[model samples]
Target: MSIDQVIEQVQAVYGSWGRETTVAQMRADWDRLFGETVSPDSSQPVDADGVCAAWIDAPEIDRDRVLLYFHGGGFQVGSVRSHFDLMHRLSAAARCRVLAVDYRLAPEHIFPAALDDALSAYAWLLEQGVPATNIALAGDSAGGGLALSLLLQLREAGMALPASAAVMSAWTDMTASGESYQTRADSDPIHQRRMVLAMAGNYLGQQDASDPRVSPLFAELQGLPPLLLQVGDRETVLDDSRMFAHKAQAAGVAVQLQVYDAMIHVFQQFPQHLTQAQEAIAAVGQHLEAHWPPHSNPYNS
Candidate 1:
């Protein structure tokens, strides 16, 4: 088996470590596995009076350019703690401070709650005098969907759009219409078909799955910022990214879709020891930096 398979097996083991395998149990195991993340340099907690966020500074630190980051946990279990290390690497490579948003999760907060928090955090950054042109948004898995949905909301509100966005393994289609959900169902190490359906049910509650805000894949994609979408060939949501990219292209959006062979969901979070993960994240950095050149930013220069 490949190293990715080994990693997936290990994660499957963790998924069963708890007594009942409840959402809480899986969360605890996931926390222990990826939550001991170290934030290099300084990290400042920002409440924005309501929205929870943290600023993970780059190794050299740049305040002018910012990346609004969202964490993935199926929209049910992740936090800044779980995605801190990934944000640190992104900040270092992008040469900007990353504002990691701690948005509300599902089954408790439901549909628009997470999206609300994300929009508020972006608004808060603008209130902080950060230029929208100097900021970008990024996330993985559920967080990736949230990031894209937020972009659509911003467009709907007639607000200034961010410079760019980078999404990793984004679950954009809540309807689960994508072919990969079946084609790669057995192959995807994480995100079982049944479990994902259950998670979606919990997140959407009485809401319609086709609501553009709920499943961004069905949303109108016009006039959004440039987008960088990366997904693993082994991802069950592979078609989620592919279909979304096609829609974005149809809408005249500049979108780059990169599919990594033999990788699993959100592999960029493993940049510490995984070569492909490192390259993927560095590509994210390159995408963002190309939009807001590192040298042009006085703080990074």
Candidate 2:
């Protein structure tokens, strides 16, 4: 699909935002547009200092497996509700429960704050006795970046890593040094240089943008778990995923990069309306199912 058509459809569902709006206000507007109850299952509060929200979907018969989902909003917007549909779909596909984290947004919390919350959420899951081998990590956009960042941190902390990870149009490079930043900027529907610059300024504040956690592409990529990256051909962050995939492969990490031609940023958002989006989501589901351990639960059937 053309980028223009995708943007038009998204705009119909999510109205335009002004540059002057605060992060809190933007989040409220997103909640109103996407509706507050995107997740059909009720959320259970996870006991953590930065816990914003969390939801669990258990299989009819329990499996040791689980998926930790992080939503994307440039680290400024999005909530557990914003990504509820995608989480439910992933949970059903993986045939295991999913724990979606509502991590703190940037501009308000800044660097390390979001990362700390994500790490805390994962640590809580570990405390619950979910084995690392049975767990998978997944996210879109900034959250996708966060998934990679979390993996790197976990490795540094000498913790066992998840079985696998799936990232959708991840913004891995906060430095915005990717060639696509210029080449695909005009074609990308949702993201532009101006908006990206604004988001970076808010998130980075006084911190260095080159911090590995802020830009996973710049981090040491060795010893990470297998990674599945889904990106749109026209996304401004296209090179972010591309470069990360290249470096990861060179560092001996099993990595797969799937690029949808002529698509916009995070096309997975319109699964019902766009053929490519549905295909992308289904592809991710298949990858998760294949990598996740076999489930004895009849509910998975």
Candidate 3:
């Protein structure tokens, strides 16, 4: 299928967000869309320090290494079931197990709840005897921002950091102040400035939009792990990834920013439908594998 066709189908489902659509209905549609595409036969459910999660194991996966994944839905909708296929691809590509977390969502859990759940999952991994150096963090959209937020929280708390992290179409700025929100308004059919701000409002409520905990784009980014940021040029929040890359690089963090022309938000989620998605997801796997601890690197073995 072409990217245009994929976009059209996505817009069909996502376009109902504000048009008399309840959150429950939207959640069901979201899950049905992605869940129906991939079966969770290989997934093993687990309680990660009280947080709902699953171990997505690749065929012949190296159990020693893990890819901790968070799904994207503006922190309101997506789930482990929705992203099972994506996590499976990531697991196979990196030859590692994927710990996909079902973190608390917003308007009910509120700010800090998602972050707390993510932190709990990571800590649970450490407690399970997985070395910090053997883990990599990844997420898409809001979950991407949440991954970064978890990293920042870990760093600030003087905790051991993961080997590296990556984000695809990361909504790093809740302020929605990026220029691409306007520049790509016409090109991107999936999201707009109003929609972006509305999602932020749902997750953030009355919390400060610029808070580093919510907007990693506004945070002090020094001392974080190497980052791979993948974003589509046509996305409304394109600048969110671009600006975050610029800031993270200037703060002395290693950053690789790949901007795919004519792609949309979280395009990697559609590997079965788009060529760019295939390439981007493969690159993500390579990035994580390449950054693992030298002795534990799967490729080296």
Candidate 4:
């Protein structure tokens, strides 16, 4: 199928999320649309402290390194199941294991709950003796923002940092302040300004929308690790990646930003039908490998 067809299907799924749609129904729809379809043998479930998660291994992988992943659902929907295929692809591309965290969602768990669970999983990884230098952080959309938020949290607490981080179409600004929201509105099939604000409000509850812990775009980004940010030029949140990359660079951090022409939000999620998606995932792998400790070559294992 072509990218247009994929966009139509996505719009169909998202359009069904009407005012009457229950959170449960939305969750199910999201899973049905993007959930795993292959055999479950490659993935093993685990409890990272109290946070539910799973470990996914590529057919051939470097056990020494890991990609700690978060799934995107505007912080209200999505699960490890929904994102298993993507995580598995990432494992293969990055040539490492992936610990996919099924973090709690909003209107039920709310703001800091998801962030807290992320911290818990990372801390659990550390407790298990996985050196921070052997780990990398990754996620898409809201989860992408969460990964960055976790990085900031770790830095502020003086905890060890991961080797690097990569985010795709990250929703870094919860305030819906990005100019792309308007400029790219006609081209983006699934998202708009109001929907963006609605998702943020549901996740934020009564919390301030501009809070850096939730909206990493507003945060002080000094001391963060090397970053690989990918966004579709057609995404309504395109500026989320652009603005965050600018800020990170200004903070004296190494940042690589790739804007895929004619792509949409989290386009990598549709790799099965999109060539650019495949190339983007491979780029993520290259970014991770380039930033890893020099002596740690996964292929030699």
Candidate of highest TM-score: 4
Q: Over the stretch 135-217, how does candidate 1's per-residue lDDT look in tens digits?
A: 99999999999999999999999899999999999989888888898999888866777778888898998999889897999
109-147: candidate 4 lDDT, tens digit per residue: 888999999999999999999899999999999999999
Better of 1 and 3 by TM-score: 3
Instruction: Point to the candidate with the largest lDDT.
Output: 4
Error of 1 at 123 (Å): 0.7
Residue 199 of model 4 has an lDDT of 92
Badly placed stretches (over 4 Å) of model 4 are 294-301
Each candidate's TM vs. the true structure? 0.93, 0.91, 0.96, 0.97
Task: Put down candidate 2 lDDT per residue, 1-301, tens digits, no spaces.
Answer: 5557668866754456665766677888766655465545455656554576575664452456778888988898888777776776676666777788888877768888888988998888888888888888999999999999999999999998999999999989888888898999778766877778678778887878778988999999999999999999988999999999999999999999999998887878776568887788778878877786776555751
Which of 3 and 4 is the better model by TM-score?
4
> How much lDDT does candidate 3 score?
0.91
Q: List the residue pairs that clash in candidate 2.
A: none
Q: Which window of ten consecutive residues has the lowest lDDT sum in model 2?
A: 33-42
lDDT of each: 0.86, 0.82, 0.91, 0.92
Alpha-carbon deviation at 176 in model 4, angstroms = 0.8
Candidate 4 clash pair list: none
lDDT of 3 by residue, 54-128 (tens): 998878667788899999998989998899999999988888899999999987888989999999999999999
Scanning candidate 1 in windows of ten residues, the lowest lDDT window is: 34-43
